[model samples]
Target chain A: MTGQVRTVDGRVAGRRGQATRQKLLECLSEMLSSSPYRDVKVIDVARMAGTSPATFYQYFPDVEGAVLELAEEMAKEGATLTDLVAGRTWTGKPAWAAAEDLVDGFLSFWRKNDAILRVVDLGAAEGDKRFYKIRMKILNAVTNSLTDSIKELQSKGRVDKTVSPAAIAGSLVAMLAAVAAHQKGFQSWGVKQAELKPNLALLVHLGVTGKKPTK
Target chain B: MTGQVRTVDGRVAGRRGQATRQKLLECLSEMLSSSPYRDVKVIDVARMAGTSPATFYQYFPDVEGAVLELAEEMAKEGATLTDLVAGRTWTGKPAWAAAEDLVDGFLSFWRKNDAILRVVDLGAAEGDKRFYKIRMKILNAVTNSLTDSIKELQSKGRVDKTVSPAAIAGSLVAMLAAVAAHQKGFQSWGVKQAELKPNLALLVHLGVTGKKPTK
Candidate 1:
């Protein structure tokens, strides 16, 4: 159940307070997209929201705290990514489709929250535990499921015993996240966006099933 | 050919000038590792370098410009990555060795310059042309060579024609870069550094040859 929204000082936010809080978040998200994370100030976010710095402080402690909030919200949406892998049978033609659909869903999710994800990435890469935890919350949704799938295959002797499911799954997930984050970078290599998805799917299938897709 | 280093004002940097420029760059690089990229200031670098901000200006325009310098230097070092792929055999045990060597070399390269590469990664993601170009310079070195290798295999009917070589190669390289960038993130998932490498090499070999390595 959703808990009551509370301000930094612990008072529950009313409808007006919640509205302003949401407004500040939206403005902060926009600022992150337009400028570097370090340059994003709480005062600037409040100014963008047409409110006072005092009002910004009422909801969030600072820019990093607000960013953590945004990242947490994105992680909730990232939970839906489990559907991309959960119960998907990685067998024959279905395996190819599973990989394709997973790639499609994951990329779209990343593209939607790329700005906040970028900051989260930077934060995690910089060794910030809070940001790192939020990133793990997101990627683990798909990774854990995929890891389970691989382990299932391994148990059936369908996959190699030497393969570590978690490493492969984590690497594959990292690949998707990296490719999604820099989708434009592929264009310069002459790999068109349309072509990237299936190739990625193929690799995902190979990484998971250790075989070329039947399709 | 290595050209003479010059100050921003067009004077050829002598031994002393070059040393000062190098010192400033070293100091800036240290600052980037210790602090956020956006917070690294010319004044701090100058102070750390035991010079004035005016002297810092004499060598580079600003923090981003100096960062570009550092990235360019790292890109030159990245050129050596070509040895991991260029003119190398990609079949049997050699293929496995190729993949392992690449993973070893690429990871070391990223770890060595990770602080600067993080800025380049952020800049590329944010659509900054200069930063994007530098990032491409570093990745294209290996990606292009790997692409040619895949194309060679495809032409010989040793690989799938349906597979986009550039897409597959770029994705693999992106996987390497991403994995290298978040090497620490993998540890949290219970994948240690030693186990991580061989699994990555396995995926690279799979993506490249469309078969698991003989080794």
Candidate 2:
């Protein structure tokens, strides 16, 4: 559906086209942050953006299309961080330290996009066909990042050989969704990482390095 | 929206109908097990037990009401198992051994009602308000069950103290959702729980007992 949206004004083509779409995307994202996906409509998004419904249709076939596009963009942005974690020179960092940094980078991204991420997290399990596709894309991006890292560690004999990297990767991926559900738990309780992050790091570290967590 | 479903007796009610409505609830439960909640419309449900839409309205206001009624029933049935877990007798079984029996009993129920569970999971998340209420009920049921077991272990000094029992309960609840998501992933791979449940149980054991599973 997003594919059908042609940026209006062929000259709304390059930088201008991108800027216009970005503005529209930005508006829809802002609205989603405060509301559930089903509650918000394309017309509502357009009105919130101070644009015409027709203008919204110019860049998005519907609300889900716009949301999926934004999700894909965020997923890509998330990918760059994964790349950073993967590409980092691991020479000075201990294996555990590297894993900690990767998760921290991931958490910070979630923090920055709290609203959009909240909506996506809430909507991902829904039966919506398009929403599921965008979600799986993001999940793959995260898993692929971890899979490559684990495979590298395995090749170097730095991690366990018995567990499949994909299984470990799946666990690492599952842990994020697990923790993210409680992101709101953070705001409500004001708990610090000294208590939470370390325990979580232990779980992921065990999954990755295949060592028993430090007691 | 569920507060208005007319029953199959073709009688909309106000006809000394309380007993007749009770019969309809029993019929609705039987029908839902064999059909998806989303697919079970008022008319078909009414026809199934020799009733009419008018009589259906006497009990449930609508479809959500029928689903809500059934979900509530399932949770209550599940609580019967919870009562055993919370008992002092322990059935003289090892903890995981007892847990396995409990899990098998619960899962057997799920296996037969896969269609309804799938519908409820999807409908509750998809934008159906009643569905969300049902989902919340299920979460509460799991939390209560775990709370009883955790408190029992804590009193015996079998559970970790550093982690809040609340976190322990929540962590377990979430791993189940992750289990469901993993099962969903398998569907794409042309697989099912036959290939996933044992691994899922291993992960659950890891999460709940804070013991790294050797399996």
Candidate 3:
């Protein structure tokens, strides 16, 4: 009830209004690259968007609210693990193979959108309460998919009977988070996508198989 | 040259003056529990500390600088992964044991000073350049130790050989992060320590050993 809603009269606003809003958010995200969330002002944001200060308030309760909105938007997407490994017949594939595909999918998302991904990292860094749920929800989805695949593999008795798929599922996500964290930190350091692929394949294989990769 | 450090003395002038400065920074971290970072102000900080706004500027240039100073102070100690897992030798302690100890250390720091941790998260959440580097440095230390252990195990053939230790290492930190994120998000939701431990342990064993518990 307290947050701002972009919709009006039960209809999503038009491009002109949306364009103003979009430009404002974009500038805000860029500003955030160097500035902290607490220090930004509505006038500063409006000026950055080249719009009237009143326009800034029209779309957002305030600049912080606008940034929160952008962060939420960023949270809504990324490459899912299942999308990496299987299409229609996931159960048919080896768990390690499926995991590799998932890692690649995740890395690809990081490669393309390091800035937005950094937002998730920062939100969860230590005691950041703001974006914790949104970030966790994303993690849960990844782990849940891994669980499904592992359960399928366990049913086939293809996986190590001593291991639980759910554990592997959660672990796999944690490992990927490290990779994403590394990518965000080193993006300005000229990280080549090729360099990270081997690491991803290696980790994914190890994560699912409970053994180090021979390849 | 452009920052608050004027290059003259680069220090507080007197003892009472220094105490006031420390109190202001310290209070912000705790006060942030009910207040969002953006909602806090110099007046609130000064009032809470029983000081004047004029006196606050004598130390910090502004509120953001004050928070950053605290984050820098915490990170100045600079812990490594080896420091965490060392001095307690085990051939291979179950994932839960190591995880519990590690989480205990992290949460101990967090619970004692939620404000600074909260600020660190906010700074990082905003993904400002400085915040990401600070986060990566701390996590990298944690991951490096786990990675080294995994590699040692690989050489001894005690663990899987095909998997990259780096992957396992990455997963370890990421999962811990997830639990920490959980703890942080539910601070007001009344989530307790008991609910968090199993999750942290589950992540460690699953991610590292890739095995379900024998216990």
Best by lDDT: 1
RMSD (CA, Å), candidate 1 to true, equals 1.6
Model 1 C-alpha lDDT per residue in residues A91-198, reported as the tens digit of each score: 899999999999999889988998999889998898889989999999998999999999999999999999999999999999999999999878876889899999
Pick the winner on DockQ between candidates 2 and 3: 3
Error of 3 at B86 (Å): 1.3
lDDT preference between candidates 1 and 3, better one? 1
Candidate 2 stretches with Cα past 4 Å from truth are: A1-5, A8-18, A81-108, A111-130, A145-165, A185-194, B1-136, B144-161, B187-192, B213-215
TM-score of 3: 0.74
Per-residue CA lDDT of model 1 for B4-78, tens digit only, reads 778898989898888999999999999999986767888999999999999999989888899999999998888
Q: Residue A191 in candidate 1 has what lDDT?
A: 81
lDDT of 2 by residue, A1-215 (tens): 44533564333356665676778888888886666454577788878777788877777767766777888788777666655356643333355566566667666676677656544653444345555665566666766666677788788987656545665566556656555544444333334544555545545555565553443
TM-score of each predicted structure versus truth: 0.96, 0.66, 0.74
Q: Candidate 2 at A86: error in angstroms?
A: 3.1
DockQ-superior candidate, 1 or 2: 1
Ranking by lDDT: 1, 3, 2
Point out where model 1 deviates above 4 Å.
Answer: A1-3, B1-4
Best by TM-score: 1
